[model samples]
Target: MICVGIDLAAEPAATAVARLDADGTTLRLRDLHLGADDDAIVAAAAGADGVGIDCAFGWPAAFVEFVSAHAAGRMPETAPTGKDGRRPLAYRRTDVEVQRRTGRWPLSVSTDRLGLTAMRCAVLLDRFARAGEHVDRAGSGRFVEVYPAASLRIWGLLEPRYKVDPDARAATLDRVLAAAAPIGTTASQRELMVRSADAFDALIAALATIAHRRGRTHPVPGHLGEIAAAEGWIALPDGGLAEVLRG
Candidate 1:
């Protein structure tokens, strides 16, 4: 099976892509791309059996409601007040579910600037969907949302620190490669992962794609699956139950 992973930054300069070959036991990094734009990302991902993109796929339910109300002139344009009295629209139910399952909170796409990346992802997903790509958000479909940081934590590997520190980053790369021992990597790929944190994340996302394809990752709970399909969900290795409600 062939899988593609994208560590999509809001700016094209920081984005990276990785291609993987999964042959039952070993998952190989077949190719890597850096500083990718939308066209480049789409081209690189073409022909892959599955794709893992590192970005939220949709808006929070409340945020969508807020936007609709504001657009229809029912509410003020300036950040419509959430129903619960707080800006509940700032975060999605799926984001909270991912946090409960992984013990790591993802940034709010509605309130945080990660929303920029989500906007980009939304366009890309739409393009793919129009091209006849079918994605069942709650299941291991043709496309899935990935969180490399959460995947690293779930795998008992290094988490957030690896990106900024050179030594930690190199060590984490080594650890990931060592785990996929049978798969060979080029010297250039190693250098790229060491020098570009985005590339390394793309690698992790590719690994997560393999996990998803192999049924090693968990699905959104039945109760929450519908919301996930509508609001977006993060894919992670199989763990505990994830509910839609956030406390």
Candidate 2:
């Protein structure tokens, strides 16, 4: 099976993509692209059996309502997250659920600068939808949402500090690639990951795609599936990522 993974960023220069080849057992990194744009992303995923993108697909249900109310020039009686005053509508139940499961807090797509990235992804998802690609909801669609950082922690791999620490970046990249041993890599791909954290994250997202496609993913609580379908859900390995790591 062929899966495409995209590490989308607010700026196209920071974006990256990876293609994974999984024969149902062993996985291989077939290609990697850096500094991609919307067209580039679509071209890369043209024939993919599955696609995993690292970005928010939808807004919080409350944020949706809040936006509508704000547009109507009326005060929203309830806070975005259904609470009282001052809580931002940034965290979705899936985000909260991920924190409950892994203790790593994902960035707020609504409040944080991630909104730009999500906006881009929203356009891309629409393009995919127009092209007849279905988002794999809970490992059932052709596309799915992915979170590489959380996926790394769930896989028992070293979660690295790539943005701030130059010294830590190389080591962190090494650990991530090492943990993804199931994906047969070459000398060049290793060098690429060593040079670009974006590439590394894209690779991790690709691995998550393979994991999800294989039906080895964890789903959100049943009650939240509806909201998650609209807001997007991060795909984590069901039990452990050992199966994907094994040679």
Candidate 3:
């Protein structure tokens, strides 16, 4: 399937892109700092089936918190998990306000293990495409997807000759694609066999952006779900990250 991963750029026009197939090996396309090139790239991957995004798609932290506190309706449709400290609800990783300051993130599997390698490949491809920023951009995005470069070893979307995360990323994103496929989207499966192509487009873009933020990038931390299981807010010391990626 033609799937894309997105690294949200705080604006639709500024987002990054990472296009790929369902298996996550074949790199259909990748880019960072898409800027004016966004439209063409989107058109190229138009038929992709799925997309993996590096940013929170539904409700940003502010809205999520408001809903949890009864200030608004739940946006994600799922509820926070882990009430007894054993099992925890895991949501997309993202930055947050902590102790009156901003820019705090819950501990998550490094990007390397959680599909950062593919992400960086997208970044490098971006440099090749537009040839501007040499480093990956690290703007506000989903907490689960973004991490320190040390956390992710890969630099761009071009498949290594190999990978470490294997099916974790493919399967996790499959959840998204399967959910969307039946609804009839702007993109479709059966045709290209690529799922979440647009979302992955942004993922590639975000990884490229992160590369720009860090001097170099690598792919590591292959077991992010496990890490989330261990460090999810429910397991944490307090009420902090409990919501995680859950609804």
Candidate 4:
């Protein structure tokens, strides 16, 4: 069984496909390109099972619900209200940048948004729903899953060379390599390690790690179909769960 994970980063998305065979863990393929073209991505994920994507599945309605619900009562208000009354989700304590240039923000902000956070989850779910009819390759899967692929880096699952910061990545890698030792570091450094956000390739590497550790083989019947929506962890049809099987 092969589990594929994709680290979906904007700004020229990078895809790294990993495979764990009897020979051990191997990064089978890596591609850097624009991922908005769905057909290309679908074709790329030919004969694979399971995939995890690092992007908003759709608007995180749940997150919005939280903001509308407790944010007013819990979080302190910002500067004194001007002409208009205060608003919720306004001047949040969060550091979401107000883009002066392109007026665009990273998924970090969207991920924090209600209903928006699940956008990618919706994408994977949709793909899995159509896997049976669309995924025509023999032994290829027909299901999908959406995971916060970045969580793998947070969980200490990654290869060494891909680490951008040598000292820090290496140190974190060491912790990843050995779980026995007590974490020896300051709080701020630990925080950065926890939040190291390398989107696409990083996530793909993480999925490889998951499959290597806990994947089971299942014969995938050739099928093709698609299902898309805005929601949370759903077991998509055609075996599309939360792993990057292709593209």
TM-score of each candidate?
Answer: 0.88, 0.89, 0.28, 0.40
* Overall lDDT per candidate, in order of appearance: 0.79, 0.78, 0.32, 0.36
Candidate with top lDDT is 1
| lDDT score, candidate 4, position 202 | 38
RMSD of 3: 18.0
Ranking by lDDT: 1, 2, 4, 3
Model 1 regions lying over 4 Å from their true place = 76-87, 239-247
lDDT of 2 by residue, 1-247 (tens): 8988899998889999999887755778889979899899989887898789988777777777778888999965544443443243677777877888798778888877799898888888888778887754444687888888888788777545765555566677666656555568888887777678788889878888878877778866788778888788888776556675442
**Total clashes in model 1, counting residue pairs 3 or more apart in sequence or in different chains:** 0
* Residues 168-200, model 3: lDDT tens digits: 445433443433232232333222223333344
Top TM-score hit = 2
lDDT of 4 by residue, 1-247 (tens): 4444444443223333332221122332233233333454455455544444444343333345555666677633443254333322232211122122113333333334433324443454467566654321121233333233223333444444434655655555454434312213344433433344343333334343344234322222123112122222212112222332222
Question: Cα miss at 114, model 4 (Å)?
Answer: 12
CA error at residue 89 for candidate 3, angstroms: 13
Estimate candidate 1's alpha-carbon lDDT, on a 0 to 1 scale: 0.79
